[model samples]
Target: MGGQPPAEPASEEYTVDQLAAKVGMTVRNVRAYAGRGLIPPPRLVGRTGYYGPDHVARLTLVRELLGKGYTLSAVERMMSELPDGALALGVFETLVSPWTPAEPEVITEQQLADRAGIPHDPATIAKLIELGIAERVDDGRLRIPNPDLLRTGLEVIKLGVPLDAIFEMLPKLFEQADQVAKIYVELFRNTVWRQFADAGLPAEGWPEIQRTLENIIPLAGQALVAAFRESMGREIETAAYEELGLPPDEFSSTG
Candidate 1:
């Protein structure tokens, strides 16, 4: 009765290994943090210990504080001053974290030529750099932000389209895409996100927000491609009819 009370075990939990993997830390480090009281003690059941969400949130906060040059003792003190669950929900600590851009792949000019199966030209590479497709590093390697887009550009170049022309078109294309993005975002802001804001921004509804955004990605892509294809088809049909010395209306009805 005089001794310290037994710890209350958490119901929903993860094993030590699972907790370590989830927090991107080593098992040894997780155990050490638990030992140092930086993380809460794990739930014990028949000699097996398990950690819960609180431990995960604490470990994340501890790692972040340590990265900022705070000592373990200092971090402990700082964490103690915060109320429960305050440090848990970070801006990125959601079911779906913010999308991380792909890392640029570093390749030699020869490697890039091999990948795209195109001739290597210094002038072309320069144009790509100017167009923001390729970046030249100090070490003489090219960084391709997107290999697929670069391949598409190279195909157009092979089709007798000048690199200068392609570069000139990029800004106008990107400007239109940006305007489309703004329109879609405004639609969401006026509808889905507006509802979230009106409901006082409950934490439980964040996953629904993430789902809506994810659903929108493919819908936007399909919509854009469909419209482009329909417009291109109409233009090609008109051009073909004109080349054959026929009126555009005849081919238009046939199409």
Candidate 2:
């Protein structure tokens, strides 16, 4: 039978199954992951472990980091490095809570099977679960832990890079990501805030700045991807394809 309503809003509490449906995993794997110490264990409410919105948010971050190139080991290690002792953990709790973005349309197991042309098996579901994409809850429903990450994961999978390969490369990607974040923080303090100090822009320019940050991230990501692709274009055009004995169409460029 369905249990009592959550102490807070249903969207805010995000029962284990609801979280699982958002990220694309099964309930069993979510519990197993908690057992493995990958994430902070959820609080048990009655017969089910109640995962709040925070777990969903962090799980999405974990998925994003993994997609960018951080291994589970590296991710766990980085998390460990976040401020020693309880104070740091408290700070981390606040920092991670607000910045997470959200997305629409809950991705379901059936939808993934249709898109990837794969079966919704336990092993595959478990892999998705640990990765923070899916959760299978006690109530027999599959949920997404982070709705924001669902769209990103779907695109990353289509790039033809296997999840294992992505997992192996995640650590390096995360290192760079941290560095970039630090640089931006410094820039915010130095140039954006200081140089424009007298501009009194938080209110006046914030709308614009928000628009700019929104526009810039995707634009910058695409620009870098293009630059990297072009840097290897000559090699591909010459004989790399022939040497590898692959089809020319694989490297076909509109450029």
Candidate 3:
């Protein structure tokens, strides 16, 4: 027998009885563990069952850990935790709807002013076109390019801030929103993908998680909008009238 190689074992599927014997546990206890989800049950094809190496390893660990005084509840809880985003950028990117642009069309400068419900003036419309906030169409007409920008600008104009002062801040806002969006994507990949998976969340479990993100995003966004509306409304009112509180003669009509 010296220098002779040992015989290779034949591949054979293990039955529940054989698996239980291999694990050194009773058949009833093995079945119970499977039912309680301490282990996944064996694959079955028409009443014949087979266990794989993964099952044996997991069962061995479960038995060893339980013997060392670990409770099933503690083990299950440790196995189930999934951590998510801590980044502020994730707030807007994942949850909120993106600004989907509508098709472009031609409209007169008078029409843009009309849409804002303000008196039409060549000076202001020309300013908007010059600043690229309004686009001048081929037919010598103008269109308000972005609705959100148009909306914010209309309010700022109403408050009597000059167009140049307001539009200067816009480029910075846009660049920052884009930068934050990139971070948001990384946050989704890291916290939701890498961290949970590192903690042992099966990728097969994602349907529940997708449903949960859908549920959570709206609630958080709604609460934030509600809180800001209340806080900003009063601050806006008080700021607008800081001059009205002073003597009428002492205050200049334009600041």
Candidate 4:
């Protein structure tokens, strides 16, 4: 008889310290997460505990959720209800990851001023930061989070719109955009996400949920742009008629 049939080779394993290092978490945090039941208890071999890939995936998921602005307690509740934490994490990421990735441009204060056609003053820099158009880095340089937005602002300025006016309009624009985004998000939440959650968040249903979300991503943007174009056309036509002192009926018939 062979000696206990040659001991099976161990799968990938990590001690508590090794697990923390592997997942880029502190040992204390790893223990804390375990205590919170966010991750399953480690396997005890003699007096020592070992963590495997599942723990690594769960910890990685928790970190990602926190980085995405989820509160710890909220993450806890979601983790607690998940049938397969790793798969759930993948679906959650697909749902929340940005549809468009923005590549930021870094420039000095003077360069930013030159591009924006504004003075290189503290007030202007502050305004840029306040409007979220730019951020100041540790090296005293500015970062344009969305260069396309900056280009649009410059184009608007070229149309004889003042920089101050653009700044003033941004807050209102943000509010309107937020409202529109909420409407779309609520539509999905009340329908797809709600149905999935109500069905006990079955593992088999995740793929369908993910597919619906991916489809909606581009469709939502297209629909929003189409609606905005129609509305803007109507508004511009009305304004032009008023400016030229034409009657509504005449404009409607000839516009």
Clash count, candidate 2: 24
Could you give candidate 1's per-residue lDDT for residues 98-137 as a string of tens digits? 3333656889988877665667878877877887889999
Clashing pairs in 1: none
lDDT of each: 0.74, 0.60, 0.62, 0.84
Rank by lDDT (best first): 4, 1, 3, 2
Error of 1 at 74 (Å): 24
Query: For model 2, how does the per-residue alpha-carbon lDDT over 1-255 read when each residue is reduced to its tens digit?
Result: 466664444445667788778766676756665665655776766566677655665565556556658887886775544322233333334344344556333556777666655566666667767765677766655677566565565567687777677655656665776776676557556765465445743334544444545554466557667866986777666576788777778866546
> Candidate 4 on 93-133: residue-level lDDT in tens?
77767553467899998987787676678887898898898
Put down candidate 3 lDDT per residue, 1-255, tens digits, no spaces.
Answer: 656754332255467888788888888977887777766666775566777665665566556556648898774553234222122122223343333345444677777777666788888777777767788767888766676677777787788786567767767866875775576557666767576567577545555556545665556457656866986776665565673686445644342
Candidate 2 Cα misplacement greater than 4 A, ranges: 1-111, 136-138, 145-163, 169-185, 196-255
lDDT of 4 at 234: 85
RMSD of 3: 18.5
lDDT of 4 at 186: 97
Clashes counted in candidate 3 amount to: 0
- Top-TM-score candidate index: 4
Compute the lDDT of residue 88 as modeled in candidate 2: 32
lDDT of predicted model 3: 0.62
